[model samples]
Target: MTKGGMESVELFTSEGKGRGLKAQKEFLPGDVIFAEPAYAAVVFDRTSTWATTTPWGATDLGRCGWKAAIQRGTWGCWLAVADQEPAVPRGAREPMASWLGLEREGSGLAEGCLVSIDDLQNHVESFSEEEKKELRVDVESFLEFWPPQSQQFGIQFISHIFGVISCNGFTLSDQRGLQAVGVGIFPNLCQANHDCWPNCTVIFNNGNHEAVRSMFHTQMRIELRALSKISAGEELSVSYVDFLSLSEERRRQLRKQYYFDCTCEHCQKRIKDDLMLAVKAGESKPSAEAVKEVVQLSKDTLEKINKARMEGLYHEVVKLCRECLKKQEAVLGDTNIYLLRILSIASEVLSYLQMFEEAADYAKRMVDGYLKLYHPNNAQLGMAVMRAGVTHWHAGLIEAGHGLICKAYAILLITHGPSHPITKDLEVMRVQTEMELRMFQQNEFMYYKMREAALKNQKIHVMPEPSNETSPSLFHKKE
Candidate 1:
């Protein structure tokens, strides 16, 4: 199972899912397993939907446009670019099957759309009517020009990408003209899977070019094993909470869109199961008593917060978060996931507060908790650590800050490699920190010497005019 720098676990191979990394020992829920940064990424969206066709926007159309791009590099075994002929330019078309959207085949993909690994990995089966309508129109239009395969050895690319989007596509934040900075987390992360009561998470670092992180919980280390059992030889599995819906409708929608099945205990039982688990385990359960106790306060606080935010009372929003934390702690208890909401709010509030130290501390704790609940190497946890370091630097705790930043930089280098944006930033910051520390030390020493001379009645001296080098006293007036 030794691959890359990691000593443990067999990774999935092209010959079949390899007997992936098996845990030699038990790992807690928030323990870190492994993380690899995306080698390279290509962004696409609604306007650029049918990859092979037209409308290659600002994004670089690498190698041979859409389908050919995937085959550029080998990204582990079992994962490969959907098979398609090279797309020649307009007047120079290749004698190949129509490659545009989704298509069916015997065992493998007869024809599949060119998509980012993450998009393909998380494909689902259901979509909203509006999305379906749009997808249908797009597919029909594409098929009108590029028909399907008729023979047994035939290959036809349909429009399943739009269908996939229709079912479970993500809404990217609108970016004007500029390439979207931080959308599209890597697809490899998708294989980690989902859970109703998940023990791992992925998060994006909004500040650092939306760098992704996978954090492990430091506080409660041992509890992680329950979510995933690592035998001497097994693939590490983390919880994916998005697919934890109990309703068949929700499950169907997720499956249709994200393309994964729900076998997690929470999804199997639905709300009733979650409710029972919460009650029996003495954890925070969604019940009449719990809701009744905190509902009013939560409602009132949220209302005020909304009003305050609308009025731009940033401080007031911070106050509300503090109150939320207190109330939630009183009612839901400290370890409850509900507090995550409060912590998230607090992190945002403190980030806005411009109190970097406080903000970083909150971020650190939240990240730690996320790692505990999910996995240490979870993207969300990594983001938290990154945020904490940035915030610490901003807060003037440069020494403390350097330590945190270094940790993030080291991890990012391993997962994302040395060329990632965050890794570069970390290196830059390291240099900057060294310079700052040197300046700070020099200034401190000078200040101390000046003060010492002043207290001792010794005249503070400066360089004399041109003749001062060998002069008896630089501060002496010519007599």
Candidate 2:
């Protein structure tokens, strides 16, 4: 796992996995292995890609990991870039392009196209008969509304392109975690293979934490950063899916989606599976029957919570989460996915509703459980801590809030790196919290009033208007 003298990562062909990237230098947590801009970033343009008059009526096909739309957008990008002359002087991007295996010499999609969709695996054999049938139908549907040039690719070629997109397309999320904007193919980033518990994570760097960006920005790039210390000569791996699921479920998804049987140590050893699916709490184990019932109930409640959130039924979300949490707290372990899910939602909704005290309480639990589940450098844990900190600050627990914010900042420095926009924002929050905490320590009353005024204005924006009319007094004694 350790290479003594190598300086950087290099491309090495794997035994059965064709080609992959490997680190030649040791990477401490938060160290950047390399960065890659999308070989092709297809912005979601409704007008350009769609007929705009479907029965669905102007739907954003590109939003939220829609596969066909990603294909269409990618095909559109190919067409867009294919015919254009080099805007920059010739060979400007060649050296890095050559390093990442991007083609520069040839013309059109077949021969010197930067996109290697033609070479990428479609994983056709991984599909069952029903899934294969569905794929064909999707291909047919895609071709129906596409431009005339799309027809020239024919069913087979188009299907191949679709297969590659299915396999390799990274769903690009704007930093806010609000929505999926589009998909991009980062050829070099794809070189790192999948691991259930990966050493590295792909980060979308746009230089602004609060600003959501479309695909057009120059700063839109993916950085491969270490989540833990990676020794030199080790194969760089990233998790293709999230860590909420059990090893079995995660491996199932890996096989179906990425077409690889995950043999990662985490999957092989079933590491932390007990913690993830624990039904016991402090010498109190629920009966198997009760645990089974509670498990189903938790999933059902989570589904309802998601539905309510999508419908903007914030109050309903709160109610469902509260009920779910109550049931889960008794029967489920603190680290149970369902319980964690409910707590996460409850915290966010309560904070948004300006119920900061309750939000901070839920957030504190969420962060605690998450810390147990995730690596110390995990970004999700960092974000949870940041949210809890902000909630505590708003709730006027300035001391605790400042401590949490500082902790979050330290964690983010590893997961997101100091140069990252989110880390920069966390630094600002840390500084502000430190100053306020000092002020409060110096004179509690003055700082309390100022904090109250700030939190009050925030609540004013979020909360409903107060009733102006006063109630009639019983002492007035109208018969």
RMSD, one per candidate, in order: 17.0, 12.1
User: For each candidate, what is the lDDT?
Assistant: 0.40, 0.63
For all predicted structures, in order, the TM-scores are 0.48, 0.78
RMSD of 1: 17.0
lDDT by residue (tens digit), candidate 2, 282-359: 766788898889899988887777677777888888899888778888888878877887788888888888898998
Backbone clash numbers for all candidates listed? 47, 0
- What TM-score does structure 2 among the candidates reach? 0.78
* Lowest summed lDDT window (length 10), candidate 1: 214-223
The candidate that achieves the highest lDDT relative to the unseen native structure: 2
Error of 2 at 5 (Å): 17
Error of 2 at 83 (Å): 19
